[model samples]
Target: MAPWLQLLLLLGLLPGAAPAPNEPRAAGAQAWELASPELLEPARFALEMYNRGRAARTRAALRVVRGRVRRAGRGSLYSLKATLVEPPCNDPTVCQLPVSKKTLLCSFEVLNELGKHMLLRRDCGPVDTKITDDKSETFSSFLPLLNKDPLSQDFSVKMASIFKDFVTTYNRTYDTKEARWRMSVFANNMVRAQKIQALDRGTARYGVTKFSDLTEEEFRTIYLNPLLKEEPGKKMRLAQSIPDLPPPEWDWRSKGAVTKVKDQGMCGSCWAFSVTGNVEGQWFLKRGALLSLSEQELLDCDKVDKACLGGLPSSAYSAIRTLGGLETEDDYSYRGHLQTCSFSAVKAKVYINDSVELSQNEQKLAAWLAKKGPISVAINAFGMQFYRHGISHPLRPLCSPWLIDHAVLLVGYGNRSATPFWAIKNSWGTDWGEEGYYYLHRGSGACGVNIMASSAVVD
Candidate 1:
């Protein structure tokens, strides 16, 4: 046996070596509970590597397993597991395979919830692997196939196990219960099914501004610095009229529209880029406008910091609002390539928007606003990294959306079958789902955090 394998077996004897055995037994036991010998060795090796140097590793040595069984497919599922090994020490004399004394079988899964995709793992919490949408459940596994897109349908043994567990547990815990994961699942699906209230394929068109044209230094000055400056109106305040109550019970799994934003590749403008997205919807909700604003404005103009990229939304919001507001994409175009924030990029403000308090229940709030228009909300940004997909549950503390550096907009709300949900707009280009949106439980704060009433915008 490989010395590394021996070390792993020896490490398994440690009292706390593996995840707690009492962890609810992966939700569903009978349906997809079978384990593979093939999975054990590879998974063990990957865990050792992660334990030894998770901070130093480059590529995630793990793979996400997702797929459908096709003709014989039962309910689909998504699973996570470890694969491959990238050791820093290639020379046997200078380095040996990292031992597994402190590693847990599901360590990688913990990292998944932590919001790091490059890291590998074997499984997620019983409820974590379940996707938030129903149509999305068709592709039940998370295993990224060798040649297939991560979003496409395909499966592997380890990944298959993930789906099987999800379905069985969901069936038992939710389906069996009067109301359980069912409500959350339906909420997510409803968001996935929504038609974009404003832009549809028939009317959608390409206009000015993009992330590719600006330099990283430029992106920061124009976009980030203004929000970060110790200036008036830059900081977001808590909702004054928000009622003090227990957190709202919500299921984000119902139907609405969802879409993936095109990857910006390796840019540090995730903060600016995400904020612009929410603001775009805000502008739309307020003025009935559909302008795709310039991310490069922050990339180039507000130079309190580096412009090429790297700044906070607090700064960006401050700069935009104080300068009387930003412009339409057509008025001040972006090059996609980044630069320092420049004076030239500060376009004239089309409108001045304010924030509102939530005095009513989320359902009541939704019903009330349903008649007016869409409202934007803020939620905590877990980490600096931009979220594309695969997240099913809350992995971080629930803070006011206004507090988190990242931002997204709340569009509409509805009941999926009978479960209630809030529809949210996403910036990850449209290929992400039925459209560029996702659903959250009506009060999950999963979409618009710290939501109450949107500060009404009069066009």
Candidate 2:
């Protein structure tokens, strides 16, 4: 009599309109109508395959919108439409979803035979389909994007979902217009990250990280140091001494020659951090007292290197000598910006006699690092932006070694399942990589890890 009642009757949601999920079926090889409860098993089997193909965060489940099971030669063929629903949160442990949301619609063809089921087809589209469900799981993931690529017709919707997850993870807030623009940028970044992941030769994973939504230009402007090459700066005196054969493994942190990880914020002051890290280790080994040195003092006092725009570790090392020494980080707290040089002689606690460059040979570099504290180095950092963890060994063509744009510290070296690696100390904070560390592949000169290898001499 009522329009709502008519709609429910048409969808087979009425009390006696369809067989209940727990209802017993007739004992004969016959076709199960759309309302038959026996078809739910094949529908669930199809959904499991669908969800398993998606990423953990984006995996979803569904309720049967419409379905039928037809008796065939050996098994029943199930053609089903289900309404997809997202998980309450993107928890990897959670595959459950509230079907009341009525998110997307998916058509799945499953062949159930001999106690096993095979998925024949799956085509999901964004639509709200009325469905009834005893249980449902999460829906939507990057798998569709993987199969479809970035140019898929439904890519806009998929990127929007991923961007929303990124924003939530990073606690980012943007206006409507800016959010839309960022979504576009995030989509493009996903494409780039996919390329990086595909071409990467090492075990390093490239995907949605802290800067997943950032454009390449913005990422470079904020985190990269472009001045390493622009101002070649002074050449350091070459170290004449080479240590004995390096041990199987070495770590300066375990030896207490390294300080806790420090964040450089949004400034291009990695040159200062790299030089200071090397000097800190040198001072600790030579003076027997490890100290966290000031990078802010370098940012302010280094006359040869540009303050925040970019600088070279070699220039920072030279500037430290000319400025009398470096004050402790406590005395010259980091403000992450250019400031008038207020380096007081009274606060200068550590001094460098001079800085010397290390040998370029990988074996020699390892020996030098093992005996003489951590070594300062520069790298191309092309894949560093997307690096999460594991050994990052990008192909030379992907990450050019000549275009060194960032500075870091080499604290140790070791082999993992026969893959030699250099334990690098990055200034991007503890959250960036493996606790502010980047493991680059060794022996192959990956990303110029051996380039710009130098250390301050503490007398």
**Which candidate has the highest lDDT of all?**
2
**17 in model 2: Cα distance from truth in Å?**
62
* TM-score, model 1 to reference: 0.41
Clashes of each: 103, 6
List TM-scores for all candidates, in order.
0.41, 0.67
lDDT of 1 by residue, 290-344 (tens): 5666666765665442332345555556555655566655666655434433444
Regions of candidate 2 where Cα sits further than 4 Å from its true position = 1-150, 153-158
lDDT of 1 at 15: 19
Residue 323: error of model 2 in Å? 1.3
* RMSD score of candidate 2 (Å): 23.0
Give the lDDT of residue 399 in candidate 2.
Answer: 62
Model 1: number of backbone collisions? 103
| lDDT of model number 2 | 0.74
